[model samples]
Target: MNVTLLMAITINGFVAGQDDDTEWVKDIDALYKMTAEAGVAIMGKRTYDECVKYNAFPYKGALNIVMTHDKTLLTKSTDDVIFTDATPQGALQLLEQKGFDHALVIGGGNINGSFLKAGLINEIILDIHPMVMAKGIHLFEGDFPYQQLELMSFTKINDDLLQVKYRVKNNYENS
Candidate 1:
């Protein structure tokens, strides 16, 4: 299955720094619209909780899978969300077995890093806002090893945002 990590970070690489009430609603609406186009959407448990707190429920028919360490959270019957303790590997394996063509990894810093560190992400679609926040959670935190990417495309979405697409470059010899 093809996996894409979708994220919106500021020019300073902070995801939550620019997040405010107004910006969050706009971001969630955009995210839901984009994820609805995909077959499946995957998110970390922390992100799921934040979504619930933010009241960003998607359409009733939309399918969502949340990765969590606690299985008890799955007991709540929700039409759109399924909880799984499946780490990155388990989640990917399940998705592969189910024959999902594409998966969108949407979230904050740690979740994005998990996918990147696991080397499971094939592509990235980053919406970079043209502002900087001096203090906030960054898109990647802690000590995760590095991977290189090749720029596939870049588009100016507006005066303040740039949409950049990148492909993970695994073969250094070709580079």
Candidate 2:
């Protein structure tokens, strides 16, 4: 399986505010398109909560996998959705067993941290918006060792939005 990390962060590398506010993320159409193309989305519980808070859960056209220790969420698992307590490697293994070819790790810091820390993400695409949140959620929130990224490419998504793609150096291989 090809695992990719897709997220939007401020120029200062914050993904959300203290209140879990994402009013700064404005490229929904682009985000939706890229995510849908992946066929599967893996996210943390908080990211799932935020999506539901805005009435946008069970992302259409893709299987949604949420990682959480909440056993109640297991009941929600179906052919199209999965709520698992799997670790980053475990989650990828599950997806591979299910025959998914590509998957996207849609974020909330800890999830990103786990995947990156496990060296499971082959690529990362960050939609860097032209804004700054002094104090909020950092891109990788959990404890992880240093990672090196090799620039793949970058493009101007809009007037002020820059989309940058990077490969996790030393770990980017055909998955």
Candidate 3:
């Protein structure tokens, strides 16, 4: 299965403010479009909550999986959402069984790190916003072994936004 870790981060690499404020994020339409095209998307509980703040729920026509240990975090059921405590590996397995050849890993930070640490991510597309925060959540939360990437493509979304795509290199155990 193909998995892409897609996110937006500050120039200094912060995904959110120290207070967990995501207002600095811009160019959400592109993100939404990418999510829509993926057919399957997964994110951590916190990332899901942040997305709800902007009412980007349901992710129409896509299977939106919320990875969380606490079931109660999900207030109620939704048509296109599946709340699961599955590990990244287990979640990918489920997606594979469902015949989804590709999935997108949407995140705040920790979830991205988990997939990277597990060697499950194949590509990363970052929408880099031009800003820097001295203290804030990073693009990848926990400590992970260094992984290399090969730049695939990049484009300027606007005067302030630059989107870059990278293929994960030397990230798999068998590589």
Best by lDDT: 2
Best by TM-score: 2
**Residue-wise C-alpha lDDT for candidate 2, range 1-175, written one tens digit per residue:** 7889999999999999879989889888788888789889999999999999998888888999999999899777898889999888898899899888789999989999988878888999999988887788989988767777999999998898899999988643543
Least accurate 10 contiguous residues by lDDT in model 1: 18-27
Name the regions of candidate 3 deviating beyond 4 angstroms: 73-79, 172-175
User: Pairing residues by index, what is the TM-score of model 3?
Assistant: 0.92
Clashes of each: 0, 0, 0
The residue pairs that clash in candidate 3, if any, are none
lDDT of 1 at 50: 72
The sequence of per-residue lDDT tens digits that candidate 1 reaches over residues 40-81 is 788877777777886864423356878787758867636567
Ranking 2 against 3 by lDDT, winner: 2
Instruction: Report how far residue 166 has shifted in candidate 1, in Å.
Output: 0.6
> lDDT, candidate 2, residue 51?
97
Rank order by lDDT, top first? 2, 3, 1
lDDT of 1 at 56: 68
Error of 2 at 146 (Å): 1.2
